[model samples]
Target: MNSNRLPLFTRADNFVKDLTLTSNQLLLIVCAYIALILNLPFLFKSANAITGLDDFNWLFLITFPIFLFSITLLIQSLFAVKWLIKPILIITVIISTLMFYATLTYGIVFDYGMVQNTVESDSAELLSYLNLYAVVFFIVFAVIPAVLICSIKISYQPFLKELFNRITLFAGATLITVLIGTIFYSNYASVGRNNKDLIDYITPYKGIDSIYKFARKHYFYPPLKFQLLDTSPQIINKNNNKHVTVFVLGETARAQNFSLNGYNRLTNRYTANQDVISFTNISSCGTATAVSVPCMFSRLNKSNYDKRLATSQQNVIDIVHLAGTDVLWISNNNGSCKGVCTRVNTQQIATTKSNPLCDGEYCYDEALLQPLREKLHKLEYDNTLIVLHMIGSHGPTYFKRYPSNKILFTPDCQRSDIQNCTQEQLVNSYDNSIAYTDYVLNQIIIELSRLSETEDVASSMLYVSDHGESLGEKGMYLHGLPYAFAPQEQTHVPMIFWASAQVSNSTPDIDLTCLKNKSTNVFSHDMVFDAVLSITSVKSKTHHIKNDPFYGCKSASFVPLPLLESAKKIQTQSSGEH
Candidate 1:
């Protein structure tokens, strides 16, 4: 009996000794551990908060181990080759570092949009997001572990045995995960649908999924080509009064804070003094410029608009240009015009020679004025459209949007890291930027008024922001929240119209009073394309009169009045005051 027990003990000891992990297997194990640790925030915070208190503990107990085990199996299966282990470790380090930095600095969920932004961002934009804290954190958490992984010596199992073991482990993990998911389908689905951001909070997997989706959408997908709204748009110049329309595209300006929109603050003090018509309710096509700018200029409405189609097709500007109208796009903002100005003349103020308003990188919104005046002077067409893209209230450097003298709001937040500032300071700084935008728009209106008088051109100005912003509201700072889940602060923007006396006199069909009365009426970026087309008198097959705000103001037969009653009323009111 003693001899039999001794042989059994020896056999158990030999079995324990033989249970060693190869270098690739050890790397997989380390990666799995890191993935679990990185995703602990999602498991403990986002997921737990969404689950009911009664089910929270059970959910965690059931899902946590499964999540870790599943991740391990997935990674091991993908990186099964012995030589691929080092490359996998390096890739993991980079992804983990980025995830950590974004989670720590911006508190952003790593969704597909965020991933798209990451992939599309230039080196400068990417560098701006990095800092000392992020570097240190990456070194401590990601790089050090990666180095350790590379340094450790590993034992290699026989090829067949290793392959069989990997297949068995992966199969077991997948079967268990599917079984658990089936058993708790109700709870899992409820939490997943209710809290879609839960998936975004999961590390490595979140990044992996986002990259996969982005790649599939951008690379694997075939490029979609869309036909122009009109193959040949016709320009019918009514009265030929040298019509000139200035479209001021604003950035990060929310309607809620605009004094002209009934905000308590004096953010629109300058614009308020002018004869500008401000719209109270205007929703953006998207919550980010990458989506909004293209959507705003496309013939398709937000619901029907596809980014690929929008980017590929000729927009309002292009169609108007094709109709024999001179079009110019002047941009003070560093962001691209999102192909809206691709076919038209473009003037980038930041790259303009000896521009004082620019520091060779970022420029004030006022920088656009000089180039605009130059372009207006050189215009030889009977009708023209000039777009001024302003860098208004762009953050997290809100204080930089305006000049020092224009910082009307005191105790403004000066730090680029806006999260470090108090809420009051953030508001003050952001308000100052809005005030400067007011000043810039006022200056443009003054320029248009001067141009109308000097050049005998009927000038008008229309302002609409690409998207609104989130100023530390609900723990979210900056914009780019998914449109489906974005707050009102990121979708509701400001739109204003200012017509010169000459324009009003020449185009009588547009009733300013009726337009003013319609200020509180709901509008959106969808109106932009049709409104611009109507304003320029460019007739196209794609033009929808219902989408144009001024279409109803015209008389029967859709003809504009040669003289404006609104212009006469203004003159009468001015004369009475005098």
Candidate 2:
């Protein structure tokens, strides 16, 4: 806080000039400020959730801050040293303040899932969160307080005495928190049990815990050797006709908003008349791309998913590639594939040669269509898998997802501060993005259809969103709530399947009518692995018939004797472990 350099902050510097406090005192004050002021989102949400049937429980409201203050104080006391106190305090307060902006503005929960998404977000994606409101909040809460912290002089005692004092502070804070919890046991217990997500709203501590967990998984844990589910996957029922399937990994497209799935709006206008059928009931593996994208591609299910283990293994793409299929990933998404595309050949659109469709920061979903059209002509393999990873409906700039000329909905919200927009305007913008997605998909389908008819190749497409979005529902906006407390808006994603006549005529298992009838049945991202394997005719023990929606209608003649023998051998070999 050099007054000469930052002259505007001179008053702030002068205000704290005479303040000389012991390290313990400074720690307590910063902790208190952080717990109360920086935790407005936490307290407000908790109050809303636990106000009961009446106005409020005044006693519980008072005790909640005391609990938060005690928790923060105890955490800070452990790091209370003359040389370290102010630095640690400043860092924590600054991060807490930023987290405050996100939680307060978008109702985001700083759980491990969201921490993954935040860390992996690219510069452009990160910048979308910035606006005038965020800047003002940062200046008033973070910068000003940080300057004051640096300006205030910390008093020192003898080293041993300072250590003893810090120890006492730690003990006192811990005892007070424990005593408060014990006294308000019934109130705290009931509220917490009913509202489990309240734990994630404990200011920046929840975020700190998530970061620590992420670091521990990526750093502290021993390096894991890359493992494959099966190394001997084979393309079964091989034929002369080439097979092409476009696996469209969608972003933030919930099923509820899709007209194909009964939404009132014509969001799926292009696909409505196309041969595609939308899966009406399907949930995502996780609420954010960082978590969902990886899990959706891996040999992992939501119940047994482990981030470290998933990253250190061959995903569905690798298995398909290994089965002698030429696989390529084209991402219009800035949030790279979260390690899912590491082993596959990938092309990032935003980094390529200049295009009129791309505006430096973002490109419309149509930007994906031209390359897709060009690639369909260059096919040199019998079985081909092209993944079009779309940046669909990612906010808080939904208006940027599609072009102005393509805007199908009126009075769309065009600003990043979506909270300030009317609900109708916000929803209109989101629906327009959905309609644009249909147009892009329709273009890709037309290209695939041409290839199928002209080149006699079997063409098909499968589209599934990584997760869903929340458009100011239940006073919550955006996505990434903890999965346990996540609303359906963040999990019930759209999955659509479209196959040219060649796919059904060539691929034995793909009974389109049967699959469409089963579309209304419950399914999840776990089914993605098997569905892809079945569509591409890749056979391995890992491709469970039970998980594939097309398998019931699969012809028994398609199963080869050697594949059956291999399955038995693998099962017999691994049966001892269980």
lDDT of 1 by residue, 305-369 (tens): 76676776678899899999999998876667877898888987754437767655678888887
Instruction: Give a tens-digit lDDT track for model 2, residues 124-198.
Output: 998998888888989999998898889899889998998888888888988989998987787777887778888
What TM-score goes with each of the models? 0.86, 0.92
Q: Worst lDDT window (10 residues) for model 1?
A: 569-578
Candidate 1 similarity to native, TM-score: 0.86
The parts of candidate 2 lying over 4 Å away from their true place are 1-13, 48-50, 53-58, 160-168, 351-353, 507-509, 559-578
lDDT of residue 71 for candidate 1: 62
In model 1, the Cα lDDT at residue 335 comes to 67
Best by TM-score: 2
What TM-score, to 2 decimals, does candidate 2 have? 0.92
Which lDDT value does model 2 have at 205?
Answer: 86
